[model samples]
Target chain A: MERVPVLKIGDILLVSIQIDMEDQVALQLQEDLAERIVATGVHGVIIDISALDIVDSFVGRTLATIAAVSRVLDAETVVVGMRPAVAITLVELGLSLPGIRTALNVELGIALLGKRDVGDEPADDEDEDDPAAVTTS
Target chain B: MERVPVLKIGDILLVSIQIDMEDQVALQLQEDLAERIVATGVHGVIIDISALDIVDSFVGRTLATIAAVSRVLDAETVVVGMRPAVAITLVELGLSLPGIRTALNVELGIALLGKRDVGDEPADDEDEDDPAAVTTS
Candidate 1:
């Protein structure tokens, strides 16, 4: 019964699941995350699953539950570093995991949470799309 | 002064934007979406933006706002049919439109919303991942 370590980094909780999680372990991680979020008062949680080659329905549901819980606690959860195969398997499993945000990697996940903190809407607006489109088309 | 027509099919509100939307028109669509969400009590909203070749920051922000508003009224919103070029442009412009779910096309968008309606968590679970892993790895 290995406990998933939840590391706190600059207002974000990083959970890198390195173990092949059992059902009980997934539930334990869920409980651990809720407590960590409340204790640290972090604004974001990045779950790095790059090492994971498989994600069944139970784990997928746990991730979604974690996202929903983190949202309630005012913390954004981003699942990062998902392999293409895992993504395909999840879709094939019919588990899209709505209410969850994802990033290609940890760096992008941090950027996404940071951008979300700047404003309610997405940031960095140049308003040049129209002008650029005019010349291209 | 073109109006974005929101069609009601089954329990979903389909907003297919087939025009070169002005800023005012985008805002109008936002208001129209909110009204339609409350008026029809649809379970979902499918915003089709495949027709538009370009999307500025204003339009992106409007889409986010629409998602937020529709959520408040208890309807899920999914943006569909985004071209690859438009996606690249949106990322370059720095607007990811958080809180809005997206699918590749209208059929997939409808499937996403339909799947969401069946249950709070994703449906269709066959827990053979362990057995599948047994042979592969």
Candidate 2:
């Protein structure tokens, strides 16, 4: 069983799921993520699922649970890199994963978490210089 | 044909859908809503779906489309008051209504819009006094 790696970038935790996850793996990832969040006291979580081509209900629920748990621990979760097909399928399958924020890619995901953490600062100046900034809109 | 009333409250447009909408009605509401958003230049929209017991894919797609349209027009959309069963059914059916924000009730929905519109203002003082502020967490 391969464990999902949760990388820490500044105050955010980055989890990039690069494989098609099994039910057990999904659950384990959820558990591991929650523990990591508590231990690190991160203010944000960015989940990059760009590699996932399909998401069944179990996977979808695990994602939602991760977001919910992170929120309870005072961290924001931004799911990014969802393919268009996966999004259409998720909606077609009736699991909108409410309460979870999404972005087109990891860069935007980080920007979202950054924005949330800063609360009211003027939009990041760095965003204006990067093409990825436009992706948030 | 019953028309969904789109009420203007301050700078936000409030829509309360009281019926299980027909496919045609949903489409009509979408058209009507886009026109209203463009015309009013409102910064936010709160859709009250508390009266809806069931939301099929057609209706779900309509909601997503409405959110997409609003975003393009520079307005934020929040769908409020979804019952737990409806949510479960939606996820089971595979329609997560991505890109659409949701709140537990109308008041919180409005606050979500309020927060989005203000961008950097101090958290709503009223939120501190109301128990509902805790719900965002």
Best by TM-score: 1
lDDT of 1 by residue, B1-137 (tens): 65665655557776666555678878888898889778877779988776567888978888888898887677889999788999999999988888889998766788899876433543224434435434444
True contacts preserved, each candidate? Answer: 0.00, 0.00
List model 2 lDDT by residue over A1-137, tens digit each.
65565655467776767555778878888888889888988888988776577888988988998999998888889998788999999999998989899988666777777675343453335643556656664
Model 2 residue B57 CA deviation in Å: 51
What DockQ do the predictions score, one after another? Answer: 0.01, 0.01
Docking class of 1: incorrect
Q: Please state the Cα-based DockQ of model 2 relative to the true two-chain complex.
A: 0.01
Q: Looking at candidate 2, what is the lDDT of residue A24?
A: 80
- CAPRI tier of model 2: incorrect
Model 2: interface root-mean-square deviation in Å:
20.8
lDDT of 1 by residue, A1-137 (tens): 55565655567776766555788878888899999899978889988876577888878988999999998888889998788999999999999989788888777788778866432654345532545565554
In candidate 2 the C-alpha lDDT for residue B5 amounts to 51
Off by over 4 Å in 2: A118-137, B1-137
Specify the highest-lDDT model's number. Answer: 1
